[model samples]
Structures are given as C-alpha cells and as structure tokens.
Target: MPGKPNPVARLFWTAAIGCPFGLWYGPPAFAATGLALTLVLMRHLGRPRRFRARVRRIARAHAETLALRRRQESFSDAYGNRIEDGWLRERAYFLDRTVLPQIGPRFADLAESERNRMLAIVEAEAAAVALPEEDEAPGDGIDYERYCAERLARAGWRAHRTPPSGDQGADIVAVRDGLRLIVQCKRLAKPVGNAAVQEAAAALRYWAGDRAAVVSNAGFTPAARRLAAATGVLLLHHDALDDIDLAGAHRS
Candidate 1:
C-alpha cells in the first residue's frame, strides 16, 4: 500500500532510481537500474487473491497424489492375498479328490505343466492309494523325501538326500547355484500344520546357506503357508515339484 509499489507507484520508483543513476552515470547504466525497477513492478502487479488460489490448487494436487499412492498399495496387498488364498484352497480341493470343475476356473486356468505339478501334489497326498502301510518300513519315508529333493534338483537346484535324522527339523540341505538352501521334508497323509512350519523356520537359522524351505507330500494349511511366506521360506507341496526340470539342475 503506502510502503510498496502499485502500477503508478512502480513507474514513479523507476523514474526515481533511473533519474538519479542517469544524472550520475550514463543512460546505459539506466538498463542496470531497470532490474531493481522490475522488482517494484512485480510488487505492483501482485494480486493476493490469485496467488492464494494457485497455492490451493497445488496443495490439492499433492493431496490427490498421496491418496492415489495409498490406494495403489491397498490394491497390491489385496492382490497378494487373493493369489495366496487361491493357491491354498485349490491345492486342498485337488488333494481331497474334489472334481476339477468344483475347484473353479482359477485352477482350470493353470497351464498344463502347472496342472501336472498340482496333480503331483495331490498324487503325493494319495499315499493311501500309492503305498501300503504293510509295505512301508521305518526308513521308507526316504522315498518320498527323495522324490521331493529330486523335484527340486530338476528345478535348477542341487538337491541332496538328507532324510530326517531326528536331530534337527530340516531333512535336506541343498545349494542352488551356490546359494545354500535348507529344506525340511514332511511326508504326511493329511494336511500339514503350523507347528511343522514353525519348527522348520527355527531350523533355518542353523542352515549355513541363504534360504530355507519346507516341502510336504501333503500340502500346507493356509496358516502354515502364511507363516512360511512371512518368514521367506519356500513352502512347496510335493505336486509343486512335478514342474521342476531336473536335467538342467543348478548346483553351485
């Protein structure tokens, strides 16, 4: 107001600085004097209402971006949950001998190889159908254990036969292309429980390698799968191994 320039005030300030500089220096110095004058011109042109509106618009845009980011994270978490749950339910249905049609389209949409893998998991659960109790011996658990390890070996892992020796939770200690992997093999006729998962996770710390895995002929329960996922263990069902490519196994 009284302190600074309006348009008329700007012209007056310009004339004041330029007139003094021109009287002392030359008109060329007037150009340098104009710079300081431009500042006064800007103050004269300033409209508080328009400036506040622009600031409000910018703040609204920033808030919208933050909201969008939060929504995206929510969607991501939901998608992950859906995938895990789908896998868990489908696995259980297949093992229970529920018809494929009853299992829904998600299971139907699986590729041929993936379907075979899932079937293998179901087949592993078919312990009642495959091997007899009278035919089984004390160490016969090694056969299924080997089957699990061989499947991993096929899938570019260097799998070893480390049968459960009753000392620790893990059954196999494998290395895939130099990264060490510890795996516990559970040959169960029924669904695996959370206790087995917790035991395997605890044994992971004893592993001298990079990863820990738990494999079961009978698939893991949803709670067990969640625990395995949270702990970074590869929770594999026996059927999952059917998809492994054993010939090109990577063991470094």
Candidate 2:
C-alpha cells in the first residue's frame, strides 16, 4: 500500500483543493485557504508568457545588446573581410566585445569630443594592419604605380603618377597645400636600399619639388633609412605607404 500522506501535506492538500470547491459545497475555511494560497503561489511563479509578442517587446528594449551583435558586420563593412583571430582582427574585436558593452545605448548620449576620441581608437586599431605583400601586389609596373598613387590619395594627399618617360626619377608627384612632393616608388620584392633614397633626393632637385619621399612595397634597408634621414627624404615602407597620415605634413 502507498504510505499515508503526512499531516502537513494532508492539511495543505485539504486547504489547496478544498478551498475552491468549498465555495460551491465544501466548508468555508478549506475553500477560502486553498483558493487563496493557490492564487498566491501562481502569482509568485508568474504566468507563462502569453504570446510571442511579449518576447518581441523585451528584445526591443535591449538596444545595447543588439548593437554589440553587429561587431562582425561593422568589421566587414570597414575592412572588406570577416572578423578573425589575430593581431589585426582581434584588436577591434577586443574594443567591441569589451568597451562597447560598457558604453552601450548611451554611446551617442556622450559629448561629441569624447565619442570621437573613443571611436578614433577603434578606427585606428581596425586599420593598423592588413597591408598586401609585394607578391600579392599588382605585377604590372604601370598598375603598381597607379596603386601607389591611389593609396596616397586615400591617405589625404593629392597624388598623380608621372609620365612613363622624361618624368625625372619619381614615379608619383603628390601636392598638398602648395608643397610639391617628388615620390620615388620602388616596387620590388627586395628591401629598398640607399639607392632609392638617393634617387628621391636627386628627383627632389630635378623636379624642383619642395619635398621628397621614397616609397617601396618591400620595406627599407637600414642604410636607406639613415640616408633618407641625412638627405631629408621621407622613407615609407609598404605598410607606411598605405596607412601614413599625409594630412599632418600638409598642415606643416
């Protein structure tokens, strides 16, 4: 036989089940206590969500949570690629996963200057890496020269590729703020040497330009760096050529 119900449970069951029926036929006290307790417990546990609309309403209120989900989307929009694990990819991911959560929906509520400062960190970190290699760059000389010109133009310098012949030694001529710059582009797999810098210095004079620079897709040798410094020519490696700020030079 099943064990007899305990006294406490027996009384609880009496109060719980009898309370409702008591209104119709059971004793007043049982009905009153049972019905009251059942209602109270139901309220405490809360009713099951009545419909999907309630869920939709809750999701709409969490705008910060929604914005954070766009991290990969923002990365793709800016960089033309998906997010991944590495210095270049993870740098922006860290900011998005960590700092942006704290800023949340109130991000736009902050003062303009503070917002710009915070976002500048993200944008710069997003752009700091991911330069293409020389082997990955265009093979054609004219195409490579055009590529360099386009890269400088994007970096806020007005750059144009020089004519194939009788263009002095520079491949690109960039001007900003009345300053003419003779740019020597050495698009080779080998690291650039002092020879490129020397050429830039000569081209600076030959082109009657106020400034000179040597840009290469491979990077500069130590000798090239030293000679560039001595000759007052700016030496830009492949990475620097793409990401360097020419607007600062324009201001100077």
- On lDDT, the candidate that comes out on top is 2
Could you say which candidate leads in TM-score?
Answer: 2
Candidate 1 C-alpha lDDT tens digits along 1-252 = 232224675688678868788778987778777766787666545543333333334334334322322221121121233223323354444334443434334333332434545444443333223221221212346776777677778777777765446537777777766677777777754546777777777777876657666765445666876776677666664544544322331110
The segments of candidate 2 whose C-alpha lies over 4 angstroms from its true place after superposition are 1-136, 242-252
* TM-score of each model, in listed order: 0.41, 0.43
Q: What lDDT would each prediction earn against the true structure?
A: 0.53, 0.57
Candidate 1, position 21, lDDT: 84
lDDT of 2 by residue, 56-170 (tens): 3333344233333222122221334443222223334444555545444433233233434444444444444343332345656678788788877877779988889987789
- What's the lDDT of the predicted structure labeled candidate 2? 0.57
